[model samples]
Target: MLEEEYQPRRQLPVHLRPPVQPEPVFEFTIRDATLADMPYVREIYNHYVANTVVTFDEDAMTLKEWRTKFSWVSKLNMPFLVAVSPTSTVLGFAYVSPWKQKAAYRRTVEDSIYLGPAATGKGLGKALMKELLARSKAAGIKEVLAVIVDKGAEGSIRLHESFGFVEVGRLGKVGFKFNRWLGTVLLQKHLK
Candidate 1:
Protein backbone atom coordinates (compact mmCIF):
# COMPACT_ATOMS: atom_id res chain seq x y z
CA MET A 1 0.00 0.00 0.00
CA LEU A 2 1.19 3.50 -0.80
CA GLU A 3 1.85 5.94 2.05
CA GLU A 4 -0.89 8.17 0.72
CA GLU A 5 -3.39 5.28 0.94
CA TYR A 6 -2.52 4.39 4.57
CA GLN A 7 -5.30 4.62 7.13
CA PRO A 8 -5.12 5.54 10.82
CA ARG A 9 -6.17 2.96 13.42
CA ARG A 10 -9.76 3.41 14.47
CA GLN A 11 -10.66 3.55 18.14
CA LEU A 12 -14.05 2.55 19.52
CA PRO A 13 -16.05 5.45 20.81
CA VAL A 14 -16.79 5.60 24.59
CA HIS A 15 -20.42 4.64 24.08
CA LEU A 16 -19.40 1.50 22.17
CA ARG A 17 -17.04 0.20 24.90
CA PRO A 18 -18.00 -2.61 27.25
CA PRO A 19 -18.94 -1.69 30.80
CA VAL A 20 -16.51 -2.60 33.56
CA GLN A 21 -18.16 -4.60 36.29
CA PRO A 22 -16.93 -4.10 39.84
CA GLU A 23 -16.39 -7.03 42.17
CA PRO A 24 -19.12 -7.52 44.69
CA VAL A 25 -18.57 -6.42 48.28
CA PHE A 26 -19.67 -9.28 50.50
CA GLU A 27 -20.47 -9.45 54.22
CA PHE A 28 -19.83 -12.71 56.07
CA THR A 29 -19.06 -14.15 59.51
CA ILE A 30 -16.48 -16.77 60.32
CA ARG A 31 -17.49 -19.61 62.60
CA ASP A 32 -16.75 -23.27 63.37
CA ALA A 33 -17.54 -25.49 60.41
CA THR A 34 -20.34 -28.02 60.73
CA LEU A 35 -21.19 -31.26 58.93
CA ALA A 36 -23.35 -29.37 56.49
CA ASP A 37 -20.46 -27.13 55.54
CA MET A 38 -18.30 -29.91 54.18
CA PRO A 39 -20.08 -30.08 50.83
CA TYR A 40 -19.57 -26.41 50.21
CA VAL A 41 -16.00 -26.71 51.37
CA ARG A 42 -15.41 -29.54 48.96
CA GLU A 43 -16.78 -27.47 46.11
CA ILE A 44 -14.53 -24.53 46.91
CA TYR A 45 -11.44 -26.73 47.17
CA ASN A 46 -12.28 -28.69 44.04
CA HIS A 47 -12.53 -25.45 42.13
CA TYR A 48 -8.88 -24.88 42.81
CA VAL A 49 -7.95 -28.46 42.09
CA ALA A 50 -9.56 -28.39 38.66
CA ASN A 51 -8.56 -24.86 37.69
CA THR A 52 -5.42 -23.68 39.47
CA VAL A 53 -2.03 -24.72 40.83
CA VAL A 54 -2.61 -23.25 44.27
CA THR A 55 -3.15 -26.82 45.42
CA PHE A 56 -1.45 -29.88 43.92
CA ASP A 57 -4.55 -32.08 44.28
CA GLU A 58 -5.41 -33.60 40.92
CA ASP A 59 -8.57 -35.30 42.10
CA ALA A 60 -11.64 -33.63 43.53
CA MET A 61 -12.55 -34.48 47.11
CA THR A 62 -15.83 -36.26 47.78
CA LEU A 63 -18.21 -35.52 50.62
CA LYS A 64 -17.32 -38.73 52.43
CA GLU A 65 -13.61 -37.94 52.25
CA TRP A 66 -14.19 -34.42 53.47
CA ARG A 67 -16.30 -35.80 56.32
CA THR A 68 -13.50 -38.12 57.36
CA LYS A 69 -11.01 -35.27 57.28
CA PHE A 70 -13.38 -33.17 59.35
CA SER A 71 -13.71 -35.93 61.89
CA TRP A 72 -9.97 -36.45 62.06
CA VAL A 73 -9.22 -32.78 62.58
CA SER A 74 -11.94 -32.53 65.18
CA LYS A 75 -10.49 -35.50 67.00
CA LEU A 76 -7.16 -33.74 67.16
CA ASN A 77 -8.84 -30.79 68.91
CA MET A 78 -8.10 -28.42 66.06
CA PRO A 79 -10.44 -25.75 64.81
CA PHE A 80 -12.18 -26.11 61.43
CA LEU A 81 -13.89 -22.87 60.51
CA VAL A 82 -16.05 -21.47 57.78
CA ALA A 83 -17.03 -18.03 56.52
CA VAL A 84 -20.70 -17.65 55.93
CA SER A 85 -23.07 -15.09 54.54
CA PRO A 86 -26.10 -13.74 56.39
CA THR A 87 -28.21 -16.68 55.26
CA SER A 88 -25.69 -19.26 56.46
CA THR A 89 -24.24 -19.66 53.01
CA VAL A 90 -20.75 -21.03 53.07
CA LEU A 91 -18.39 -18.58 51.41
CA GLY A 92 -15.03 -19.96 52.42
CA PHE A 93 -13.19 -22.08 54.99
CA ALA A 94 -9.96 -22.37 57.00
CA TYR A 95 -8.48 -25.04 59.19
CA VAL A 96 -5.34 -26.29 60.88
CA SER A 97 -4.03 -29.83 60.83
CA PRO A 98 -1.11 -31.50 62.60
CA TRP A 99 2.12 -30.48 60.93
CA LYS A 100 3.40 -33.95 61.55
CA GLN A 101 1.77 -36.97 63.18
CA LYS A 102 4.78 -37.67 65.38
CA ALA A 103 4.24 -36.89 69.05
CA ALA A 104 7.12 -34.44 69.11
CA TYR A 105 5.30 -32.25 66.56
CA ARG A 106 2.11 -31.85 68.54
CA ARG A 107 2.59 -28.13 68.99
CA THR A 108 3.06 -27.48 65.28
CA VAL A 109 0.28 -27.21 62.73
CA GLU A 110 -0.22 -26.44 59.07
CA ASP A 111 -2.96 -24.12 57.84
CA SER A 112 -5.22 -24.62 54.82
CA ILE A 113 -7.66 -21.98 53.57
CA TYR A 114 -9.94 -21.76 50.56
CA LEU A 115 -12.66 -19.40 49.34
CA GLY A 116 -15.50 -19.93 46.90
CA PRO A 117 -14.87 -18.47 43.45
CA ALA A 118 -17.47 -15.76 43.96
CA ALA A 119 -16.07 -14.83 47.37
CA THR A 120 -12.38 -14.29 46.62
CA GLY A 121 -10.24 -11.11 46.66
CA LYS A 122 -12.57 -9.30 49.04
CA GLY A 123 -10.41 -9.60 52.17
CA LEU A 124 -12.21 -12.72 53.44
CA GLY A 125 -8.95 -14.68 53.25
CA LYS A 126 -7.31 -12.36 55.76
CA ALA A 127 -10.29 -12.48 58.06
CA LEU A 128 -10.27 -16.28 58.01
CA MET A 129 -6.51 -16.35 58.63
CA LYS A 130 -6.81 -14.02 61.60
CA GLU A 131 -9.42 -16.22 63.25
CA LEU A 132 -7.58 -19.42 62.35
CA LEU A 133 -4.37 -18.16 63.91
CA ALA A 134 -6.19 -17.05 67.03
CA ARG A 135 -7.89 -20.39 67.38
CA SER A 136 -4.66 -22.24 66.73
CA LYS A 137 -2.92 -20.26 69.43
CA ALA A 138 -5.76 -20.87 71.85
CA ALA A 139 -5.47 -24.61 71.11
CA GLY A 140 -1.84 -24.54 72.35
CA ILE A 141 -0.33 -24.64 68.91
CA LYS A 142 3.03 -22.88 68.76
CA GLU A 143 4.06 -23.08 65.14
CA VAL A 144 2.17 -22.55 61.89
CA LEU A 145 3.51 -23.67 58.55
CA ALA A 146 2.27 -22.72 55.09
CA VAL A 147 3.27 -24.65 51.99
CA ILE A 148 2.32 -22.53 48.99
CA VAL A 149 2.82 -23.24 45.33
CA ASP A 150 5.39 -20.79 43.91
CA LYS A 151 3.96 -20.04 40.49
CA GLY A 152 0.39 -18.92 41.07
CA ALA A 153 0.16 -18.27 44.78
CA GLU A 154 1.94 -14.97 45.18
CA GLY A 155 -1.12 -13.50 46.86
CA SER A 156 -1.05 -16.24 49.49
CA ILE A 157 2.67 -15.65 50.13
CA ARG A 158 2.08 -11.94 50.64
CA LEU A 159 -0.86 -12.67 52.91
CA HIS A 160 1.18 -15.00 55.10
CA GLU A 161 4.11 -12.56 55.19
CA SER A 162 1.79 -9.75 56.22
CA PHE A 163 0.85 -11.90 59.21
CA GLY A 164 4.55 -12.26 60.19
CA PHE A 165 5.17 -15.63 58.54
CA VAL A 166 8.81 -15.91 57.46
CA GLU A 167 10.10 -18.01 54.63
CA VAL A 168 11.92 -21.00 56.13
CA GLY A 169 12.77 -22.88 52.97
CA ARG A 170 11.70 -23.82 49.45
CA LEU A 171 11.81 -27.05 47.48
CA GLY A 172 12.17 -26.87 43.72
CA LYS A 173 9.99 -28.84 41.33
CA VAL A 174 8.45 -30.72 44.19
CA GLY A 175 4.96 -30.89 42.68
CA PHE A 176 3.80 -31.84 39.24
CA LYS A 177 0.40 -30.60 38.06
CA PHE A 178 -1.22 -29.52 34.82
CA ASN A 179 1.54 -31.31 32.94
CA ARG A 180 4.20 -28.97 34.37
CA TRP A 181 6.60 -28.88 37.26
CA LEU A 182 5.76 -26.66 40.19
CA GLY A 183 7.70 -25.63 43.29
CA THR A 184 6.67 -24.57 46.78
CA VAL A 185 7.44 -21.82 49.23
CA LEU A 186 7.53 -22.81 52.87
CA LEU A 187 6.76 -20.14 55.40
CA GLN A 188 6.57 -20.44 59.17
CA LYS A 189 5.33 -18.38 62.08
CA HIS A 190 5.38 -18.86 65.83
CA LEU A 191 2.53 -17.89 68.08
CA LYS A 192 3.57 -15.76 71.02
Candidate 2:
Protein backbone atom coordinates (compact mmCIF):
# COMPACT_ATOMS: atom_id res chain seq x y z
CA MET A 1 0.00 0.00 0.00
CA LEU A 2 1.35 3.44 -0.92
CA GLU A 3 0.91 6.16 1.63
CA GLU A 4 -0.53 9.34 0.20
CA GLU A 5 1.28 12.55 1.12
CA TYR A 6 -0.71 14.67 3.59
CA GLN A 7 -1.28 18.28 2.60
CA PRO A 8 -2.47 21.21 4.76
CA ARG A 9 -5.09 23.62 3.52
CA ARG A 10 -3.87 27.18 2.93
CA GLN A 11 -5.07 29.79 5.45
CA LEU A 12 -4.89 33.60 5.21
CA PRO A 13 -3.19 35.43 8.08
CA VAL A 14 -5.46 37.16 10.66
CA HIS A 15 -4.23 40.62 9.66
CA LEU A 16 -5.16 39.93 6.04
CA ARG A 17 -8.84 40.57 6.85
CA PRO A 18 -9.47 44.17 5.87
CA PRO A 19 -8.85 46.27 8.95
CA VAL A 20 -12.25 47.41 10.20
CA GLN A 21 -12.78 51.13 10.07
CA PRO A 22 -15.34 53.06 12.09
CA GLU A 23 -18.39 54.25 10.20
CA PRO A 24 -18.20 57.87 9.15
CA VAL A 25 -20.60 60.03 11.14
CA PHE A 26 -23.56 61.25 9.13
CA GLU A 27 -23.48 64.78 7.76
CA PHE A 28 -26.60 66.93 7.55
CA THR A 29 -27.68 69.83 5.42
CA ILE A 30 -29.74 72.27 7.45
CA ARG A 31 -32.62 73.91 5.64
CA ASP A 32 -35.92 75.69 6.15
CA ALA A 33 -38.62 73.19 7.03
CA THR A 34 -41.67 72.55 4.87
CA LEU A 35 -45.08 71.13 5.70
CA ALA A 36 -43.87 67.73 4.60
CA ASP A 37 -41.32 67.73 7.39
CA MET A 38 -43.91 67.80 10.15
CA PRO A 39 -44.02 64.04 10.53
CA TYR A 40 -40.28 63.69 10.89
CA VAL A 41 -40.08 66.69 13.21
CA ARG A 42 -42.73 65.13 15.39
CA GLU A 43 -40.83 61.88 15.47
CA ILE A 44 -37.68 63.53 16.70
CA TYR A 45 -39.44 65.54 19.41
CA ASN A 46 -41.47 62.58 20.60
CA HIS A 47 -38.32 60.50 20.83
CA TYR A 48 -36.80 62.87 23.37
CA VAL A 49 -40.00 63.27 25.35
CA ALA A 50 -40.13 59.53 25.56
CA ASN A 51 -36.53 58.60 26.29
CA THR A 52 -34.41 61.47 27.59
CA VAL A 53 -33.89 64.36 29.98
CA VAL A 54 -33.33 66.85 27.17
CA THR A 55 -36.95 67.89 27.38
CA PHE A 56 -39.05 68.42 30.49
CA ASP A 57 -42.35 67.66 28.85
CA GLU A 58 -43.55 64.16 29.53
CA ASP A 59 -46.33 64.08 27.00
CA ALA A 60 -45.58 63.97 23.30
CA MET A 61 -47.29 66.54 21.16
CA THR A 62 -49.70 65.35 18.56
CA LEU A 63 -49.19 66.05 14.87
CA LYS A 64 -51.79 68.80 14.89
CA GLU A 65 -50.11 70.47 17.85
CA TRP A 66 -46.76 70.15 16.09
CA ARG A 67 -48.18 71.79 12.97
CA THR A 68 -49.49 74.69 14.97
CA LYS A 69 -46.19 74.96 16.78
CA PHE A 70 -44.24 75.17 13.54
CA SER A 71 -46.74 77.63 12.14
CA TRP A 72 -46.25 79.90 15.10
CA VAL A 73 -42.49 79.79 14.65
CA SER A 74 -42.86 80.67 10.98
CA LYS A 75 -45.08 83.61 11.83
CA LEU A 76 -42.34 84.97 14.07
CA ASN A 77 -40.05 84.81 11.02
CA MET A 78 -37.72 82.74 13.13
CA PRO A 79 -35.66 80.03 11.54
CA PHE A 80 -36.97 76.48 11.86
CA LEU A 81 -34.32 74.14 10.53
CA VAL A 82 -34.58 70.47 9.78
CA ALA A 83 -31.30 68.62 9.54
CA VAL A 84 -31.66 66.31 6.60
CA SER A 85 -29.44 63.91 4.74
CA PRO A 86 -29.12 63.77 0.94
CA THR A 87 -31.96 61.26 1.07
CA SER A 88 -34.23 63.83 2.83
CA THR A 89 -34.57 61.95 6.11
CA VAL A 90 -34.92 64.40 8.95
CA LEU A 91 -32.39 63.46 11.60
CA GLY A 92 -33.04 66.39 13.91
CA PHE A 93 -34.34 69.94 14.16
CA ALA A 94 -33.70 73.26 15.90
CA TYR A 95 -35.54 76.53 16.19
CA VAL A 96 -35.98 79.78 18.09
CA SER A 97 -39.17 80.84 19.77
CA PRO A 98 -40.33 83.88 21.71
CA TRP A 99 -38.59 83.86 25.03
CA LYS A 100 -41.40 85.72 26.68
CA GLN A 101 -44.95 86.69 25.86
CA LYS A 102 -44.22 90.40 26.36
CA ALA A 103 -43.52 92.62 23.37
CA ALA A 104 -40.40 94.01 25.03
CA TYR A 105 -38.94 90.51 24.79
CA ARG A 106 -39.50 90.19 21.08
CA ARG A 107 -35.83 90.31 20.23
CA THR A 108 -34.96 87.41 22.55
CA VAL A 109 -35.80 83.86 21.59
CA GLU A 110 -35.47 80.53 23.36
CA ASP A 111 -33.68 77.83 21.45
CA SER A 112 -34.68 74.18 21.32
CA ILE A 113 -32.99 71.22 19.67
CA TYR A 114 -34.16 67.64 19.38
CA LEU A 115 -32.40 64.76 17.72
CA GLY A 116 -33.36 61.18 17.03
CA PRO A 117 -31.58 58.79 19.41
CA ALA A 118 -29.37 57.53 16.60
CA ALA A 119 -28.44 61.06 15.60
CA THR A 120 -26.92 62.08 18.91
CA GLY A 121 -23.15 62.38 19.57
CA LYS A 122 -22.27 62.92 15.90
CA GLY A 123 -22.33 66.76 16.04
CA LEU A 124 -25.75 67.08 14.44
CA GLY A 125 -27.00 69.11 17.40
CA LYS A 126 -24.12 71.53 17.12
CA ALA A 127 -24.56 71.95 13.40
CA LEU A 128 -28.27 72.53 13.76
CA MET A 129 -27.68 75.09 16.52
CA LYS A 130 -24.97 76.91 14.56
CA GLU A 131 -27.22 77.36 11.56
CA LEU A 132 -30.16 78.32 13.73
CA LEU A 133 -28.12 80.99 15.46
CA ALA A 134 -26.96 82.36 12.12
CA ARG A 135 -30.54 82.64 10.97
CA SER A 136 -31.56 84.16 14.29
CA LYS A 137 -28.92 86.83 13.98
CA ALA A 138 -29.92 87.51 10.40
CA ALA A 139 -33.49 87.98 11.57
CA GLY A 140 -32.34 90.40 14.31
CA ILE A 141 -32.71 88.09 17.28
CA LYS A 142 -30.82 89.58 20.21
CA GLU A 143 -30.50 86.61 22.53
CA VAL A 144 -30.71 82.85 22.34
CA LEU A 145 -31.55 81.01 25.54
CA ALA A 146 -31.50 77.31 26.32
CA VAL A 147 -33.31 75.87 29.33
CA ILE A 148 -31.55 72.64 30.12
CA VAL A 149 -32.39 69.86 32.53
CA ASP A 150 -29.19 69.70 34.53
CA LYS A 151 -28.72 66.01 35.12
CA GLY A 152 -25.08 66.28 34.17
CA ALA A 153 -25.64 66.56 30.45
CA GLU A 154 -22.03 67.52 29.90
CA GLY A 155 -22.10 66.96 26.19
CA SER A 156 -24.98 69.40 25.69
CA ILE A 157 -23.55 71.96 28.07
CA ARG A 158 -20.19 71.68 26.37
CA LEU A 159 -21.71 72.12 22.96
CA HIS A 160 -23.51 75.28 24.07
CA GLU A 161 -20.39 76.55 25.79
CA SER A 162 -18.44 76.02 22.59
CA PHE A 163 -20.91 78.39 20.91
CA GLY A 164 -20.51 81.14 23.54
CA PHE A 165 -23.47 80.23 25.72
CA VAL A 166 -22.98 80.95 29.40
CA GLU A 167 -24.93 79.73 32.34
CA VAL A 168 -27.22 82.52 33.56
CA GLY A 169 -29.40 80.81 36.16
CA ARG A 170 -30.33 77.55 37.84
CA LEU A 171 -33.69 76.57 39.28
CA GLY A 172 -33.53 73.61 41.61
CA LYS A 173 -36.31 71.07 41.78
CA VAL A 174 -38.27 72.74 39.03
CA GLY A 175 -38.63 69.72 36.81
CA PHE A 176 -40.16 66.44 37.83
CA LYS A 177 -39.48 63.24 35.92
CA PHE A 178 -38.52 59.60 36.40
CA ASN A 179 -39.72 59.77 39.98
CA ARG A 180 -37.32 62.57 40.86
CA TRP A 181 -36.99 66.31 40.76
CA LEU A 182 -34.44 67.77 38.38
CA GLY A 183 -32.77 71.14 38.29
CA THR A 184 -33.11 73.47 35.33
CA VAL A 185 -30.14 75.42 34.11
CA LEU A 186 -30.46 78.43 31.89
CA LEU A 187 -27.82 79.00 29.26
CA GLN A 188 -27.82 82.06 27.05
CA LYS A 189 -25.82 83.08 23.99
CA HIS A 190 -26.28 86.68 23.06
CA LEU A 191 -26.08 87.53 19.37
CA LYS A 192 -26.37 91.27 19.67
Candidate 3:
Protein backbone atom coordinates (compact mmCIF):
# COMPACT_ATOMS: atom_id res chain seq x y z
CA MET A 1 0.00 0.00 0.00
CA LEU A 2 2.15 2.85 -1.25
CA GLU A 3 1.04 6.33 -0.25
CA GLU A 4 1.10 7.30 -3.93
CA GLU A 5 -1.38 4.60 -4.77
CA TYR A 6 -3.74 5.35 -1.88
CA GLN A 7 -7.22 6.56 -2.79
CA PRO A 8 -9.76 8.02 -0.44
CA ARG A 9 -12.67 5.67 0.15
CA ARG A 10 -16.02 6.80 -1.15
CA GLN A 11 -18.67 6.68 1.50
CA LEU A 12 -22.30 5.86 0.98
CA PRO A 13 -24.80 8.62 1.60
CA VAL A 14 -25.49 9.04 5.35
CA HIS A 15 -29.11 7.93 5.17
CA LEU A 16 -28.14 4.85 3.20
CA ARG A 17 -25.56 3.53 5.62
CA PRO A 18 -26.51 0.84 8.13
CA PRO A 19 -25.55 1.27 11.75
CA VAL A 20 -22.17 -0.35 12.30
CA GLN A 21 -22.75 -1.09 15.97
CA PRO A 22 -24.65 -4.10 17.24
CA GLU A 23 -27.83 -3.67 19.25
CA PRO A 24 -27.21 -0.20 20.64
CA VAL A 25 -26.67 -0.08 24.40
CA PHE A 26 -27.10 3.70 24.35
CA GLU A 27 -28.98 5.44 27.14
CA PHE A 28 -32.29 6.94 26.10
CA THR A 29 -35.84 6.71 27.40
CA ILE A 30 -38.85 6.14 25.18
CA ARG A 31 -41.90 7.90 26.57
CA ASP A 32 -45.14 9.53 25.51
CA ALA A 33 -44.77 12.74 23.51
CA THR A 34 -46.02 15.96 25.04
CA LEU A 35 -46.85 19.41 23.74
CA ALA A 36 -43.52 20.55 25.18
CA ASP A 37 -41.69 18.23 22.80
CA MET A 38 -43.23 19.86 19.72
CA PRO A 39 -40.46 22.34 19.02
CA TYR A 40 -37.77 19.70 19.20
CA VAL A 41 -39.86 17.32 17.15
CA ARG A 42 -40.49 20.00 14.57
CA GLU A 43 -36.79 20.76 14.36
CA ILE A 44 -35.91 17.10 13.93
CA TYR A 45 -38.42 16.49 11.14
CA ASN A 46 -37.94 19.82 9.38
CA HIS A 47 -34.28 19.04 8.86
CA TYR A 48 -35.24 16.20 6.51
CA VAL A 49 -37.89 18.33 4.90
CA ALA A 50 -35.43 21.07 4.07
CA ASN A 51 -32.31 19.11 3.22
CA THR A 52 -33.10 15.47 2.45
CA VAL A 53 -35.39 13.40 0.26
CA VAL A 54 -36.08 11.04 3.17
CA THR A 55 -39.33 12.91 3.60
CA PHE A 56 -41.42 14.06 0.64
CA ASP A 57 -42.30 17.32 2.42
CA GLU A 58 -40.14 20.04 0.90
CA ASP A 59 -41.16 22.80 3.28
CA ALA A 60 -39.97 22.86 6.86
CA MET A 61 -42.85 22.26 9.17
CA THR A 62 -44.04 24.95 11.52
CA LEU A 63 -44.34 24.32 15.24
CA LYS A 64 -48.04 24.95 14.82
CA GLU A 65 -48.21 22.16 12.29
CA TRP A 66 -46.50 19.77 14.69
CA ARG A 67 -48.82 20.80 17.50
CA THR A 68 -51.82 19.98 15.35
CA LYS A 69 -50.40 16.60 14.51
CA PHE A 70 -49.63 15.93 18.14
CA SER A 71 -53.17 16.80 19.05
CA TRP A 72 -54.55 14.56 16.37
CA VAL A 73 -52.41 11.60 17.34
CA SER A 74 -53.27 12.11 20.98
CA LYS A 75 -56.94 12.01 20.13
CA LEU A 76 -56.47 8.71 18.38
CA ASN A 77 -54.69 7.22 21.43
CA MET A 78 -52.18 5.74 19.06
CA PRO A 79 -48.73 5.54 20.68
CA PHE A 80 -47.00 8.84 19.92
CA LEU A 81 -43.63 8.61 21.68
CA VAL A 82 -40.25 10.30 21.95
CA ALA A 83 -36.73 9.25 22.88
CA VAL A 84 -35.29 11.46 25.57
CA SER A 85 -31.72 11.69 26.68
CA PRO A 86 -30.62 11.73 30.31
CA THR A 87 -30.40 15.49 29.95
CA SER A 88 -34.01 15.47 28.78
CA THR A 89 -33.26 16.47 25.22
CA VAL A 90 -35.42 14.84 22.63
CA LEU A 91 -33.10 12.47 20.77
CA GLY A 92 -35.91 11.41 18.48
CA PHE A 93 -39.60 10.70 18.10
CA ALA A 94 -41.89 7.96 16.76
CA TYR A 95 -45.61 7.65 16.34
CA VAL A 96 -48.43 6.03 14.41
CA SER A 97 -51.31 7.64 12.56
CA PRO A 98 -54.45 6.11 11.15
CA TRP A 99 -53.71 4.56 7.77
CA LYS A 100 -57.06 5.74 6.57
CA GLN A 101 -60.09 7.57 7.92
CA LYS A 102 -62.46 4.78 6.94
CA ALA A 103 -64.02 2.55 9.56
CA ALA A 104 -62.59 -0.59 7.98
CA TYR A 105 -59.07 0.84 8.39
CA ARG A 106 -59.44 1.67 12.06
CA ARG A 107 -57.15 -1.09 13.20
CA THR A 108 -54.44 -0.25 10.71
CA VAL A 109 -51.89 2.54 11.15
CA GLU A 110 -48.77 3.95 9.57
CA ASP A 111 -45.67 4.43 11.70
CA SER A 112 -43.23 7.34 11.47
CA ILE A 113 -39.85 7.67 13.15
CA TYR A 114 -37.37 10.53 12.87
CA LEU A 115 -34.22 11.39 14.78
CA GLY A 116 -32.26 14.58 15.18
CA PRO A 117 -29.21 14.92 12.94
CA ALA A 118 -26.77 14.64 15.83
CA ALA A 119 -28.69 11.59 17.10
CA THR A 120 -28.49 9.48 13.97
CA GLY A 121 -26.31 6.40 13.31
CA LYS A 122 -26.24 5.59 17.02
CA GLY A 123 -29.05 2.96 17.11
CA LEU A 124 -31.75 5.29 18.36
CA GLY A 125 -33.85 4.25 15.37
CA LYS A 126 -33.86 0.62 16.36
CA ALA A 127 -34.83 1.43 19.94
CA LEU A 128 -37.60 3.76 18.90
CA MET A 129 -38.97 1.22 16.44
CA LYS A 130 -38.93 -1.65 18.93
CA GLU A 131 -40.91 0.37 21.44
CA LEU A 132 -43.27 1.74 18.81
CA LEU A 133 -44.20 -1.75 17.65
CA ALA A 134 -44.90 -3.00 21.16
CA ARG A 135 -47.05 0.03 21.92
CA SER A 136 -48.86 -0.23 18.60
CA LYS A 137 -49.80 -3.84 19.27
CA ALA A 138 -51.04 -2.98 22.75
CA ALA A 139 -53.11 -0.17 21.27
CA GLY A 140 -55.07 -2.71 19.27
CA ILE A 141 -53.38 -1.97 15.97
CA LYS A 142 -53.69 -5.08 13.83
CA GLU A 143 -51.61 -3.81 10.95
CA VAL A 144 -48.63 -1.47 10.96
CA LEU A 145 -47.30 0.14 7.81
CA ALA A 146 -44.17 2.05 6.97
CA VAL A 147 -44.25 4.31 3.93
CA ILE A 148 -40.62 5.09 3.31
CA VAL A 149 -38.91 7.06 0.61
CA ASP A 150 -37.64 4.92 -2.24
CA LYS A 151 -34.27 6.69 -2.28
CA GLY A 152 -32.06 8.29 0.37
CA ALA A 153 -33.90 6.27 3.00
CA GLU A 154 -32.53 2.80 2.58
CA GLY A 155 -31.53 2.64 6.22
CA SER A 156 -35.13 3.15 7.25
CA ILE A 157 -36.27 0.41 4.90
CA ARG A 158 -33.69 -1.94 6.32
CA LEU A 159 -34.59 -1.04 9.90
CA HIS A 160 -38.26 -1.81 9.36
CA GLU A 161 -37.47 -5.04 7.56
CA SER A 162 -35.30 -6.08 10.49
CA PHE A 163 -38.40 -5.83 12.68
CA GLY A 164 -40.50 -8.14 10.48
CA PHE A 165 -41.93 -5.48 8.25
CA VAL A 166 -42.05 -6.68 4.65
CA GLU A 167 -42.11 -4.83 1.37
CA VAL A 168 -45.74 -4.99 0.43
CA GLY A 169 -45.76 -2.53 -2.48
CA ARG A 170 -44.03 0.39 -4.12
CA LEU A 171 -45.18 3.55 -5.85
CA GLY A 172 -42.66 4.84 -8.36
CA LYS A 173 -41.94 8.48 -8.97
CA VAL A 174 -45.05 9.68 -7.22
CA GLY A 175 -43.37 12.62 -5.54
CA PHE A 176 -41.30 15.38 -7.11
CA LYS A 177 -38.91 17.22 -4.82
CA PHE A 178 -35.54 18.94 -5.00
CA ASN A 179 -35.79 19.06 -8.78
CA ARG A 180 -36.16 15.30 -9.03
CA TRP A 181 -38.87 12.65 -8.98
CA LEU A 182 -39.09 10.36 -5.98
CA GLY A 183 -40.96 7.21 -5.02
CA THR A 184 -42.18 5.32 -1.96
CA VAL A 185 -41.55 1.83 -0.59
CA LEU A 186 -44.43 0.47 1.41
CA LEU A 187 -43.63 -2.01 4.19
CA GLN A 188 -46.21 -3.72 6.35
CA LYS A 189 -46.28 -5.87 9.51
CA HIS A 190 -49.26 -7.72 10.84
CA LEU A 191 -49.70 -8.21 14.57
CA LYS A 192 -51.04 -11.39 16.10
Query: What does candidate 1 score on TM?
Result: 0.88
- Between candidates 1 and 3, which one is better according to lDDT? 1
Off by over 4 Å in 2: 1-15, 19-22
Candidate 2 lDDT tens digits, 17-131? 7777998768789899987899999988888788877788899988999899899999989999998888889988988999999999999999988888788888898888889
Top lDDT hit: 1
**Residue 93 accuracy (lDDT) in model 1:** 97
Better candidate by lDDT, 2 or 3: 3
Q: Write the per-residue lDDT of candidate 1 for residues 1-192, one digit (tens) a residue.
A: 999999998989989989878965689999999888899999999999999999999999999999999999999999999999999999999999999989999999999999898888899999999999999999999999999999999999999999999999999999999999999999999999
- Most TM-score-accurate candidate: 2
Q: Order the candidates by TM-score, highest first.
A: 2, 1, 3
For 1-192, candidate 3 gives per-residue lDDT tens digits of 999999999999999999787864668899999999999999999988998998888788999999999999999889999999988999999999999999999999999999998888998999999999999999999999999989899999999999999999999999999999999999999988
Model 1: residues with Cα > 4 Å off, grouped in runs = 1-25
